[model samples]
Target: MFLQRVANRGIGLGTLLERAARRHPANILVFDHDLDAAPQLGRRATVGEAADAVADLASRLWASGIRAGDRVVVYKSDGFDITLLAWSAARIGAVPVLLSPQLDGATVETLMRRTGRPHLVTDGAKLQQELSEEVFDASQSVLLVTGSHPRARTLGSFAGVERVAPLEMPPDHPTLITHTSGTTGVPKLAVHTGRTLQARFRPQAAVTAPLRGRQVVAIHVSFVHSRLVTALAISLLRGYPVVILADGGTAHVADLFAGLKPTVLEAHPNSYLQWEELADDPRRPLSGVRLYSSTFDAIHPRTVQRLLAASERPAPVFGQLYGQSEIGPSVVRSFSRRRRQDADGRCVGVPFPGMTDVRVVSRNGRPPSAENPGYIEVKSDGRIVTYLGEDERYREQVTDGWWRMGDVGYRTKWGCVHLLDREVDLIDGFGSTLAVEDRLFGRVPQLAEVVVVPGADGRAVPVVCTRGDVPLDRAAWEAAVAGLPPMAEPVQWKQADLPQTATTKIKRLELAKLLAVGAGQEA
Candidate 1:
């Protein structure tokens, strides 16, 4: 609705490329394969070449039975292929859905069922294993194979449809239909327009590295999520040679850095935290990276220490800051060493150049003072596009153009803002707002990992782990925890190796699910 009401929005991704082509036709646009690994000029395509490629892909999609507004899903490992397909879908007003390639066959099938996309653009093997013949018959979904898919029909097999005809798309055309992680609940689709994404990126263009030759590593996972969205756009717009990590596991990142030697590393703090465990690893130090950025949460103190120690050169370029799907491709950035490593919290750096307004708000939805942590609400140069089916969620979340990201943090005594926790993560067990496991981990050193959630017995419980030796020092641990406020202590503590997300974060929802399942078994 917000996008529909806006004016002069360009046709999402393709038109942007058309404009880019017009400005710099010969400028190198994208570099796909890793120079060190597969070493191929993945594509030396200029803006003009890119635009032409989109048209070619559009023709290909149309021949394969896709049409305007129809969903075209991409679940592949290659980021360059994803970009080309996404751009092609945009060229024909098709809703491009990008998904993580790591998803198993069943998950991919389920997602396809949910989107009801008539066409799936993936390579051969996935088609044979994941997609059922019945499901294919039901939707008449064409499997367009790019790489070696063992079970795919050739492009010539589907002949009657028009090859590649360019279709006009409105400015508010939806280029991307992305989904949240759905770790806590059902994954909801968020539709983004050309304008929404471009406006978000334009401000960041000035703040981020110039769109030219640079070795950039996309450390984030590709799951039709905002983080991947930013990484892709930054790579394309900045003309950076991207090194896509085949694996995003905590253990794999160090190897990626060592092999690729990227100039810029776009990473989340969870991975950085895991890097802390390798502080003494001989190859821990990051080389070639000029700017090291951490997003999603404040860099943990341990992680900061590791990074500080790992830089090959003196005074490693390190910084941490905030951004969300709703308001920022460029939200708030802190480059200063003092602010970057300030675990106590500070401004998320001054707002990006075009960010209009950002503030700390109370639980009741009113603005809070610099010292009081509250929800982070932002009014940016370009607000979010909108949720697909949940229009009310959008309306309620965005007030006077400021998007209320559910995070709770306060502005520092200075201009910096500090995020405490998210509203959903704070349990109301005994009526006090507390960061459940986050607080406990800080208190208990013996615990290697912990996840606190509402237990089946209608009380808060923390599932914990230790390095080894089941030292049931419960009395000591409880006494130490008792010093914490009532809300901070867990009513029960269960011991186990903590479950982590693919991104290595403790899966709180999965933990809740496990608790519910255990309750069901007991019953």
Candidate 2:
């Protein structure tokens, strides 16, 4: 694997952005909201203008007392302004943490406390409504707003301070931190350095199908973990016109493709699978999309097939990527229809061009056999610098040279890798081991989405959402589920629209809580 044996690069993410700015100063760097929206900031921000703005912001942030190694949380959805802030923070050597704008003040507080940084960068809405007036008293650090929406403080306070310009830093400098949507417990923050990010983007960096200097519409939220850091960055770095839709949800995934005609479409499985509802429409959902890629969790193979079939071209434009916050973006990728046929929907293609190594190992540390599954260990130049607060956990994750990802997978007889599931998501029930996804979707029909979740009582069941309003024939679904091996049938089924993460993954933990509340009410 390309990610395993390679050496680290000395170049950091700050240097990369500077390189891009110099190469294409006049070109359009980022396009926010819609092409026609006037309130949008990046409506006309050229590369030179964006670079200058980032430098200006960086300088102001530093002058306001933001420092290198200090944690700065960015609580906004995907847009030109927020991303540019991220670049600005990196240039100034500040570690900017990406958080969901939807996160409540309590959750935000918890995250802020974890990094021991009281400063935050957020929109005007959150500062007033969610954080309340106390956010200023809650932290000793400064709060900077993204736009003119009246945040905790105005940007004009530091008038004459020199703008912090981009500078070269070591590749191992901690640039970004994101929490993984863990299956079993609270999310863990995965750190990534500039070197790790470069390795992840190298292979697909040159492939600009959907976002090739074309108008790109991103519905994926910035806080949804890996989408923004991985797939979305690939588009932004290419100088594509990025239009981030703030109001859209999974329901609008197909619409973004059809309406925007993006050269490429990057979304999550749940978002793409929902397009099955539009299958009956004579018009194609993703009519003008040149490439469609998905990452985060494994998108079911059936979902991938249906998405391909539903597209304007029945041929596969689907790309499956494997990535993590700790390891930066995608280190592996599998693309095309033929490749889809051979995939189980969980194989995140091969290692990217510069990724050092990726491997599946058993308990003994040797490679696992074809029939055996083990922890996935990868070593790359692009791995994270360190965890935010969990130094011990971070150390345990790093072995001799590889980072032991808690995911369980093994290679095929032909040497292709297949993810069985995350080790954390394994459910021990009826003395049989199972992945929640395998039990739920394998038994359901035409399922737009499903989550195999552990109930309050520790029993695992299915929470499902279908594409249409058609009532499920309970008897048929029950019989079909019953026919599966005993371990596969969900203990109970609760059908409703399943909630999704920003990246379009079913938030099983959220659903489980919902289902638990419903169960309590029934009792």
Candidate 3:
């Protein structure tokens, strides 16, 4: 209703590119890799060509028996096609359930079962490698996005299928379904309707209003994320040339940015952490950036300062938003060049004025404070209606109009929200493991990743990964932890060895369990 009342139309992913083409037919989209679904289209295309590709893909999906109200699960290899396939599926009024390529075969099978045996879109590489034959057992039918399989028909098989007109569904129709990060266990599907998604779009889009003309927007966000829907919508509709990356390796990104010189960029916080090295590159990959937006929560202060410094703009702003898939962008904060390098990373900004609100509820009888952080709860029109197959589970997280963020934090006197730790991740004697890690990040520049979790012996352990896989200097480590709460001698591990969610968020519990078996223990 928010979007309809303002724009007189609802947010429909299926027709997004088509609408964009109407406004700016020649707007360009550049990709770091070829799209698996439309590899023939090459690495770049005009908005009009992209619209035609989506329409053609929609017809093929319709020919494959995917219809309005049907559920189609996309579990293909990692590529931008994952995002475009979502659009094509929605164009035909089929709900797209996107699972990350990082998920193993067992996890994919589990999710497919949860999706009511939906038709699966995947590729040959997955079928031969990560996905076991069990996926076919759980899926209604297998349709390949690229490579072929004896059990699945390839999208190329339906090439000449007549284009189908985009179907118009009600504003409340389920537009997309994306999974939770699954840090704790099996991920749950979060369902989003058009109107709810558009509510998220408004506040985020409003922030970009002051920018004159068009700007090239480069993004390295996960392909399956709900944020991509709104992000692509905002950029494309505004006639901005776009750059999308499938890989987040620093070398690849450095080359791309150096050559293309995008003005606006958005990426996951961890990706931003990785990109900090690009600041010192001779090519000045990040110099042209005017706005740095981290579409994830609680980025380290050091990473923020490093990236802002890389931008040669007179006044660059780093935008950080705190939220999860269940509730879209609950709160936002921005950092300018004038801010201190050691700004408090825990103080994740305030809620959106009218579109979002937050209240900290005490777990104990005492008032919520830094020492006794309370449960972070939020109210947003953008909150999902339900978990795909777990309505009761979704209901349990909501009280009145507020949804629990499952994080413990307190609001400052100035109304700044200070995130302390995940409620489930809290340690018995530790004040805030996250805060300690934040401090270590700022003090020791060598740390690429630092996670403080409970060791098997019940002592707080700091697991660290250094940039370039170099060993951390012993003296610097000691000096950094001098004033902090006591922790075990640091355990060094390769960043790849640490368990991570699809979004690159470290799985603290999984790492602790693995540590119980001497996994990733470096002397």
Per TM-score, the best of the predicted structures is 3
Comparing candidate 2 with candidate 3, which one achieves the higher lDDT? 3
Error of 1 at 185 (Å): 1.0
**Taking the tens digit of each residue's C-alpha lDDT, what string does model 2 give over 277-338?**
55455556555555666655566665655556665654546666666667644445545555
Residue range 1-523, candidate 1, lDDT tens digits: 1222334354356555665566555555334343211123344455566666566666777776678888877766545556667777777778887765646666666666767644677665556665555546434465644434334544435434454656667657777876655555555567777667766655554556543354554455544555555565555554555555434544566665665566667766656655554445566536555666665555544345456566565455566656665565434554433433324433355555434456776866556653345777887645657766677877899877778877766765556665666667655533222343444545555655555566655566666565343543576577655644452233233333344433345656667667666531110
By TM-score: ranked, best first: 3, 2, 1
Q: RMSD per prediction, one decimal?
A: 6.0, 4.7, 1.7
User: Residue 373 in candidate 1 has what lDDT?
Assistant: 54
Clashes of 3: 0
TM-score-superior candidate, 1 or 2: 2
- Quick one: how many clashes does candidate 1 have? 11
